[model samples]
Target: MASTPVDHSAPDTAARSKVERFRANPWLALTAVSFGLLMVQLDGSVVAIANPAIGRDLGASTAELQWVTNSYLIALAASMILGGKLGDRFGRRLYYLVGIGGFVVTSVAIGLVGSIEGVIGFRALQGLAGGILMPNTLGILRAVFPPKRFALAVGIWGMVSAVSTSLGPIIGGLLVEHVDWESVFYLNVPIGLVALVFSAVVLAESKNSGGRQRFDLLGVVLLAAGLVALVFGIVKGETWGWASAGTLGSLALGLALLVVFGLYETRQEHPLLPMRLFRNRSLTTGAVMTLLNFFVMLGGIFFIMLYLQNVRGYTPVEAGVSTLPMSIASLFASPLGSQLTSRLGARVTIPLGLLLSGAGMFGMLSWSVDSSYATMWPPFVAIGLGVGIVLPATAATIIGNAPVRDGGVASGLQSTMLQIGGALGTSVLITVIAGKVGSSLFGELTGAGVPAGVARGLEKAEDAVTMGIAPVSGDMPAQLRAAVVEGSGQAFVNGLHAAVTVTGVLCVLGAAAAAVFVKGRAEEARDMRAQAEAAGEPVGVVAAH
Candidate 1:
């Protein structure tokens, strides 16, 4: 008797109100998207700090520890393009929701796993989920924000990424020191839940809305297999001996598969990656720059953390705290880089950033067994500023210059470069360190008065350091302990210097590539207009900052 007529306009009115609120304060939307991105970035770095503790608890060998990290990276790299395509074809919001849920579940599973193999498997699953979430973060931002404000939004996004990744070690260190290694993985559970709820509530649905999309199953398989083989060969080369049939065959097979994949994509009607995208020099250059940037930065960080803990006898917490200067510097430098890009363009900023990073890597050559944090922080700050500037600018360049229909693909490609570069960097640097240590450890130990028999027996010290274990374990003769400690420390420093030198050289080459290949803002705008016109879309600039 008390029932009234239904208000049919209520749903539409609520939807309109939400859209208006989003328009009024896009920053709120940015906050919502950035949370998921922050979680993904945090997980990438936090696990690095926990790797040693994980090995200790699970009794994982050096190769298994390397697999723990590489498996996640390789899986993410392999699936990222597919994830981006899925988001484009379906909806970004839906994929993002699934990604967050999967990531949370896997994180919990990893924490609960008892064996190293289980942890590695679950970590790979976590990476697959992350691959799905990451590209959508930028796609949604591009969808919501206009080009005028997009540069600043990207800067803010980069800042959140830099800060979260930078602080991951500190957070992980505290968790591992005070709680346990499992606590590091469990930390993601609450953060992920909060991000998932916020994303569902605050984010709007967006998709390509273009012609019908197609999946390339063969492309996916080839890429995944090729990358797995490549990374495996690089990671295991030291143990397998560079000249061994196993290592050489893996490398050759991976290269052949990749070559075939590239050729096949060129002929496909709807390729996973459009071969024509490479014609856009800015996009190509940006992708390469991102790859080189993370290669040097992440690889260096991996060894530095080990050096701090295993060589210098610092605890995980102490090692993490000592690197705060770099993180703090990056916090400020990111915004400054955004401002610089708005004025100077990526062509200039990117090269300058590379040069600065190269200088920082060269500075690391001065490191020694006796060097203190005081000597290290200056180089840290330099590197932080360099990465802070380079990463955001290149990200903006690639995404801004991309066509609207291809935003998700561009984002995924950028992410793919980053993960692949990081994986390769870690593998190559670890290999370099192992080679250097293998050659030098025996001589150093013998020179330090370690008997020839003991020196040969302690040859495993190279593996120990690579795995983040101290050279001298358990009680030993005082003289022998001293010899072993000194020898190990010196050998590690030598390897670190060699790795840093290679990084420095690569950074210089990256600068050259950026200068030559990245176009200016005016040219980039014209190119975007050309692309939009060719696609029969709006004839104005699609993504000019």
Candidate 2:
């Protein structure tokens, strides 16, 4: 059952009879949905860039710094399924508008927050709103365009997303340089407002049009707590030994809750996640690939932002602009990559794309105190092209295999994976990087010209450089500062090297997963049409050539 081209028929009496069918106005609906939902895509991409500025402005400690990114991502992961179910039960457009409005308002709040606590709280609300918006975008797209044009519309949506991804750093950088970190949040206000106003005018509401459905409140709480605890453990594990009580406790509790979640989901009628979805090899593998790709993509980006600012001594603007070449390059590669997906097929394209990302990540290992833009550009280009190639095709796989009845849930699961993987990636990499920093104590002592005798004394596991603050230990004066600088710089370099290596490996695994497991596009579409026909749902006229 291969997917044929869309049966573009004239507005026949039969074609025009159905409310759901994509008729002469289908593209109109598609465009409106794309524009209306643009804010979520934009926020996911741009918001991370403001982290450094926010930290400085609010005088955040190390632990609280991680919250700047994770708070939004963690809440988004927890609530996405619930949002999708709500969209299915109620009108998607209603939830969509509410979610978009919430995002706009919260972005402004994040901009205005004077304390780290305020930022974290608003970020959680923003994440919840973003969760509601993401699944709705795909659902609305399906409701608008005929099945035939769905891929193209989705492709464009992905392109905008890539654009948004690239936007975060650049926009955040610019605003931070010219105005303040608050401006980055402020920019979203207008863009979101514009999208919100237009959507109210042009978008149509669509839903399951069925009976009431149960909301999984317990599952939501359990899952949110589990992820927060798990991520908190990962981000802090380097500081608190993995064997320490706090680290062990969070891990045990998080895993236990997730286990309970799996058991509860199966027994519930109309479960938030139907176990049957996992039965499809394509869905399982596609979701895994999606998770893996997003993991490396986000991890690498977050790490680079830190590297650029902390180690490279770049301003926020410089760090933002540094990524511009990659972003701009992706703008062109993204569309071209979509065309390649149909031609080469997923097997060829997915692997090739990941291989490119791996190569790019490996290229980043060349970064050092002596390095310049030259060392960074090649890898950035590789990642941009690779990411652009994988995104659209991966999306098609996710949507292609999902049943129309469970569209919102399926889409929500996919969105959850994207956000969760990203959150987890940041958490994991932060720990790894911190470990690299802590272990660099010896190198810093040696590089700073500490006497072999003195350096030997510095070997205890505590912050040895700061430990040098002892009166007897402070005699070296200039040597102590030099050692600290060398150590800190090398620590950053070491962490970047380790992080990129991890990202490259994950990208390879993701590529392999996509190649081996994802379904053929045509087979999925055939299954969808067959299921629709069997359910006594209107299948619409499969347009005559």
Candidate 3:
């Protein structure tokens, strides 16, 4: 029997065909990348709406509930830069597939967990997967798209990220109200599966061929330890007493470790984060701006969700629905802000956005037990518009300022700042609110005609409010129920006001920093053009306007 002659060129032909198909349909590539990014963004806030339900079902304490969220954030923040570095060294498509697979498995485990501890553990794993998944989205996009089309692709990427993040609470709320709390985690499973399949089929493998590849295991450990210590200190400050040894020691240790990490990075030939990037004033300013932005944004979301569900007695779906104005405004404002950045420059536009955010936080101070949706929606809109405008400008500033060779590092830094800021904001704000609520609850309740004994009892149970669990109306004595609800509502409002005021002050500081440090349009354009010329890439019109 004779064998047919082997077609030696078949593999090469198939490869060419695949490449041509991808080039012909860039939108299809975008769709696959966006699906993975959407899943990551969605997870960021979806669990927020389900927090109350998770607490009730697991009988978790306020601290435990916080850990559920913080664990994920800390893991994500700590590993993000490393993830980006790994993607650059290895194949992005391979890492992305592993990330999606791990994310799906973790999501399933989280949904099936019987205890809060299990949920927290699984959530951290999910975030680790997210850290791996997210950085590659931009990397893959950059690899596939031409430089001329990069800005447009990034714009669409930013839009998808913003929309998915905004939709999290709404989707989680609907699931929690109609299906189950577990449904929120389970929801990611299907999304991940679809993303994995599409990515495997459409995504091409890409890696940086220029530098020597090395993993900074020591840096990763130090960074993770520092963050955990810092966040732990903040989260536990109320219980440990802010001046106590536990709180002071943890904070001091965290700061010292970070300082060490910075010093170590400076010495390393191939550092996890190249310290030289911070030499760019605009990048530093943009990083600081993003940090503050998420600090206010995430912290505000945590408290507002509690107020709507626990204080105002709205259902999860209703609470989510009430926040629609902010999301809608953000959808419009992000694209508009991109245009404004081109005309006004990040110096003016970034500060303007921060100012709006500060104003929105100030407006939130007027919220009380008696405030209505009309009053609430205005602040929501202000915040949405501010965040919508600020995020893209800040991201552009960071990425734009970097040498083209260091783009991945610049992007990873931005994401790391975002997650860390969110974690810190949630921790610090929750601590402030908890401390205020605990100190004032008894006095306020007694002043409202609650008996001293009953006031003491209610004070003991104040965690219900701070942890996002509503007191069961049926369980309370009819006379005390009304007073208790009113008193607790006032206390929560007071705490919320204090937190918002603090956030407003930070926003003002961020705005001032942006004004001082971010460059004007002409200077930034010149710098970008120089970078492009140095790299031997054509200076696209997108670099100008």
Candidate 4:
């Protein structure tokens, strides 16, 4: 009888082993996905810094240089939703691998092409790949992580993104200065390789287990066309003039196509993006918050860089170095925001973050051509902390509210908003700066001791002044040159003040919207669980509370 005792411990041991494996799988998946995120973010940030070098080596014109960036933006913004749908329909891991692999290949191709045209074409392809890769990273995370741990995982992901973005200028400057521009593209190879390995080894394949859902071909065409038109208009608005027929026509057509697409989707049995998802207030609010937040963040960064380099005459490396406090603070703030969102809810945390960000922008109103580093660094830290806090909180709020089945689509929507917001921010702020400088240049120049005749002659230099560069020629008298320089700097600072003032106001309004709309943690958890249950996923899968 004693010898016949059952070996029940074997079953218990096996169960423990299974539990341990599942627990660790999420983090491993995070690691795998982050590489793709890192490569994409780093590439985007560094490429802008590398543009001048790219132009010099390839004998590119200004328009050609602009295309180098625009082609990628158009492709990325257009294909993002389609990419997510493809991943949702097929396998996220499959598309993800394909994406990273294509990105790597295209990046290499860009360096080897030896022509600006080829670089532009390859950049488009790279954007398509990025569109595919980005949302799936979130999709994979959404699938693997338990609801309880999702926010923290997303927080880490945000941290990685923020840090990489922050590091891009510095890295690009170093590589372009010391190495060659090609190195920036080649940098992706090793990172991609490691990502491929980890992803292949660790990521479990997941898809919408629906029975052979038909692809929304028409929806794809409409959405892509709509997005392309909209983004093209937004990107070109500053150059084409905001009220020009081209911009107005493109925007109108885009809106019309999107409206048609929405109607078409509502009729589809298995639509690319489920319109029903918008039924969740949290998702809608998160999306709006994402758009507005990036509008301020990216737009603000644009002018700051101009002020630092073009006005204050700092080198690219020095400007990047000055922003280190922001990077460091962001690293800390992301995780903290995640914890706060978990406990106090997005309603509290998002507004708090936005308020802090608004205050930071307001603080920057005091910056001048001769402003000290002490004044500069505090606002940088505040912005870093605020952006870090908002990034994850919004991401978690958006992705956490959706069912696992539609995770990729939701992720894509969020990403599309981000791209559009960034584009709008940069373009609109540029326009604002240019306009403000144009109107104030003559007055500022005359006031700064330049003769009225000379100041009137410099009216044509508003564009240069907007960029923080004075249009003084070396042939000019020393006093005149100094006056021109002083005037130009002041004019640019005035533009900066205008841009930040608008941004600060936007942040305040965005915060109020978030407070009114976003649900608390408990309510959000219940909604998530209910949605998961309706989708027939196990309730325990998202049991946040």
Evaluate all candidate structures by whole-model CA lDDT and list the values in order.
0.81, 0.70, 0.78, 0.88
Say which prediction, candidate 1 or candidate 4, comes out ahead on lDDT: 4
Q: After superposition, how far is residue 104 of candidate 2 from its true place, in Å?
A: 2.0
Query: TM-score for each prediction?
Result: 0.91, 0.84, 0.88, 0.95
Residue-by-residue lDDT tens digits, candidate 1, 229-303: 876776567678778999999889888998888899998987876777888889889999988888877887888
Please give, for residues 403-470, the per-residue lDDT of candidate 2 as tens digits.
65566777787787787667667767766665665577567656756666665665553232221122
In candidate 3, which residue pairs clash?
A: none
Candidate 2, residue 147: lDDT: 54
Q: For model 4, how does the per-residue alpha-carbon lDDT over 153-177 read when each residue is reduced to its tens digit?
A: 8889989988898888899889999
lDDT by residue for model 3 (300-415), tens = 77788888877887876787788888788778777677677766788987888888988999999889887888889999999888888888788778766765445556667788
The per-prediction tally of clashing pairs is: 0, 2, 0, 0
**Which of 1 and 3 is the better model by lDDT?**
1
Give lDDT: candidate 2, residue 518.
Answer: 66
TM-score-superior candidate, 2 or 4 = 4
* TM-score comparison, 1 vs 4, better candidate: 4
Candidate order (TM-score): 4, 1, 3, 2
| Ranked candidates (lDDT, high to low) | 4, 1, 3, 2
